[model samples]
Target: MELITYWISILPELGNGVINTLIMTFLAVSMSAVLAVILAMGRMYGPRIISTLCKWYIEFFRGTPLLAQLFIIYYGLPSWGLNFSSFTSAVLAFGLNSGAYVAEYLRGAVQSIDKGQMTAGLAMGMTKFTAIRKIILPQALRFVIPPWSNDVIYTLKYTSIAFLVGAQELMSKAKIIASFNFRFIDTFVFVAIIYLILVLLLTLFFNWLERKLKIPGFEIKN
Candidate 1:
């Protein structure tokens, strides 16, 4: 069919877009996870000043729109003598925005653990920070996995927003094809299906990971 041939012709460009989208998602997810850990630890265990600063950072990111954040990173930062490529701007925006939400999830997981665990660690002659690092973090990390999976999926889909910053992500390529061929419906539907498939795959993977890491008879305290 002519439609089939048209799709075939465009697939290569869209495939490259998928590759960029995946790379952006991976980098954003990784950066966010690392930032989340630092923010969570600071908010939960740091001194008064550090805790306050961490709290405000999380709040600021969580309160603002992600689109606005992306705009600031890509368009507004040039005024401050800082410049980043569109891809880098997208990654940084997504990472910082997602970090705020991920940090909150991690903090909640940490809080769900019994306070007595920390007391026990301290009684064993461990410093507060050491006890947290050695004993508490492992449990919290495992507990945080379910929520973290959702965050990863979110980050994956949110990569489409990168197109607004002129990053050549999946959606951007679809738009280009549509513009050239005037086949908006087919191009957009194809992109949507691609996104759906990616989300479903991630869901299945996370479910398997959760089952594998589950602790026998372990219940997070309410």
Candidate 2:
């Protein structure tokens, strides 16, 4: 009963944390989407050198630990005189890390598109780059929605990592609250419930989006 009351009383503080978490997730997801488009374009259509560089970049981020990336951005970069606020560092780290995964999702979508689409665009006098941007990428973006939604959920959960960087996001706020009352179990359990709720809501939204964007007469094979 006391625990329940305590939870209710602290809702305002936790709400602030939730806002911060949402901010980080929103910014990171936006950055990741932009980077994903650029990286996917480079990998699929750029010259050999650009393609190779994009490949290397995707592999590096995918191969490494996100936590390590966050540390380097938040901590290590300070010594090099390129410092950022904790919130900024967290956003950058999550964005860069998520960008690699989102790029692969986009690349797979692009490949699933018919090769004939590009040819049709070029035969109409469109440059290869223009054709890709106008003809191929729009279709690819629609196709990529399902997998990209999963990435958004992942980013939302991953914001918890920002706590280690002293970003006062959800997990960080939870920790501060728990420390005062020494109710770690209650605090974390509540936080987990909050996360689960957010994930469910996102899943529902994406499902609706996938259906809405789906072509009536065409389907892409998974």
Candidate 3:
């Protein structure tokens, strides 16, 4: 009863945290998506130097943990004269980390397209670059949708790490509340429920999206 009362009274604070969380997640994912596309393209068709750089980027980020990266961004960069606010650090770290995985998924999708597709476009008056832009990418996007959705969901969960860097997202809100009220159990239980509900809704949305976007005759498994 006491926990319930406290929760009711503190709901507004938590609500603000939710808004912050959503902002972080959206910004991070948007940044990650753009970087991911560029990295994916670089790995797939760019010159050897571009491909090597892209490969190194993906390997470095995916090879390491997100928490470590967040810490380095928030704590370590100041020594090098690169400074960022808490929220900026979180978003930058999460976006760069997520972009690596997204690049791999997109690159795989791009590679799965038949070589003949590009060839056919080239034979029909399209330049190689035009053939890639007009012919290859369109087909690759369909195959990437499912995996890309997974990355989005992962990014939603990843926003929790922002709080550790003092970004004031949902997890940070819960931590502050729990410390003040000394109600760790109740606070975290509620937080877990909120996270669970969000993930469930996202999963359902992706499922619906897959069904809607799936073509009847196009076999996407490559």
Score each candidate by Cα lDDT.
Answer: 0.92, 0.93, 0.90
RMSD after CA superposition, every candidate: 1.5, 1.1, 1.6
lDDT of 2 by residue, 123-222 (tens): 9999988998899988999988888999999999999999998998999999999999899999999889889998999999999988888888666665
Off by over 4 Å in 2: none
Give the winner by lDDT: 2
Segments of candidate 3 deviating more than 4 angstroms: 1-5
Residue 84, candidate 2: Cα error in Å is 0.5
Q: Which pairs of residues clash in candidate 2, taking residues 3 or more apart in a chain or in different chains?
A: none
Better model by TM-score, 2 or 3? 2
Clashing residue pairs in candidate 1 are none
lDDT of 3: 0.90
Clashes of 2: 0
- Provide the global lDDT of candidate 2 against the true structure: 0.93
TM-score of each: 0.96, 0.96, 0.94
Instruction: Report model 1's TM-score to 2 decimal places.
Output: 0.96
Model 2 misses residue 186 by how many Å?
A: 0.8
Highest TM-score against the true fold, candidate: 2
Better of 2 and 3 by lDDT: 2
